[model samples]
Target: DVKVTQSSRYLVKRTGEKVFLECVQDMDHENMFWYRQDPGLGLRLIYFSYDVKMKEKGDIPEGYSVSREKKERFSLILESASTNQTSMYLCASSLRDGGYTFGSGTRLTVV
Candidate 1:
């Protein structure tokens, strides 16, 4: 079975702090992505990587970044956490675009 594990289900951080969210997939996949869900903004892509050591910025990568040093693992970094950055972060991995298996997601709250 394919699975994606998120290290944490929830997090609370102070403004201006650095935050890290992690995701790992059991299956070997070529693509991995990070997305943040907000009330009005909906689901906005933060970053994605297609291969080890290669990443691409997604739709809303302003205050976030990502790392993919090894296959099956992806990390999302909030450089300077802000209250507005609070959202539900989703991580997904797939062999290709047609099949995206997502983790449970990490809900972040900044204050």
Candidate 2:
């Protein structure tokens, strides 16, 4: 089975702190994505990397960034965690013409 594992199931951060959310996929897929899901907004893409060291910003990329140094691992970075950044973060991996496989998601709260 294709599986994505997130480093945390929940997280809490204070304003202005740097936060890192890690994700790993076992399928060795070529594409990985980060998205933040909020009520009424659905899943808004933050960033996506089609290959190692290559990334593209998505709809809501402000205050967020991503790194995919290795084929199996992808990381999401919040340069300065803020109250507005608190939401459910999901990691997904996929290949061409394939459906995305998502992690369990991390529910983040910034106080």
Candidate 3:
């Protein structure tokens, strides 16, 4: 079975702090993605990468960045945390077929 691992299930940060969320996928997937979900807004993509050292910006990436240093690992960074940025972050991996294997997700709270 395919598995995507997110390093944290919950996080609490103060405003103006930097936050990092990590994800790792075991399978040799060709694509990985990061998305943040809020109450009113559905899952909005933050970033995605198809190959190592190659990344594409997603729909809402205002204060976020991503790193895909290795094929199995993807990391999401919140440049400066804010109260409005608190949301559930999801990580997913997929192949050419477009079926996604997702992590449990990390819930971030900024106070």
Candidate 4:
């Protein structure tokens, strides 16, 4: 079975702290995406990678960065945590056929 696992289900961090969110897929998908879900903003894309060691800036990538060192692992990094950055982060993986499999998600709260 294919699975996308997130490192944390919930997290709390202080302002200005660096945060790391990790995601891993067992399906060997070629594409992975990072998105943050907010009340009004909906799901905004933060970063995406099509292959190992290759990343692309998504809709909102100002204070966030991503690293894809291996085919099954993708990491999201928050340069500096802010209150506004608190949200439910989702990770998704897909193949060339175009259907996505999402992780359980990590809810982060920045205070």
Highest-scoring model, lDDT: 4
Residue 63 displacement in candidate 4 (angstroms): 0.4
For model 1, the superposed segments whose C-alpha errors exceed 4 Å read none
lDDT of 2 by residue, 1-111 (tens): 769999999999999999999999999799999999999999999999999999999999999988889999999999999999989999999998779999999999999
Q: Residues 1-111, candidate 1, lDDT per residue (tens digit)?
A: 779999999999999999999999999998999999888878888899999999999999999988998998999999999998988999999887558999999999999
lDDT (CA) per prediction: 0.93, 0.96, 0.94, 0.97
Predicted structure 2, TM vs. truth:
0.98
RMSD of 3: 0.8
Error of 3 at 86 (Å): 0.2
- CA error at residue 15 for candidate 1, angstroms: 0.7
TM accuracy, model 4: 0.97
> How would you encode candidate 3's per-residue C-alpha lDDT over 10-38 as one tens digit per residue?
99999999999999999999899999888
TM-score of each: 0.95, 0.98, 0.96, 0.97
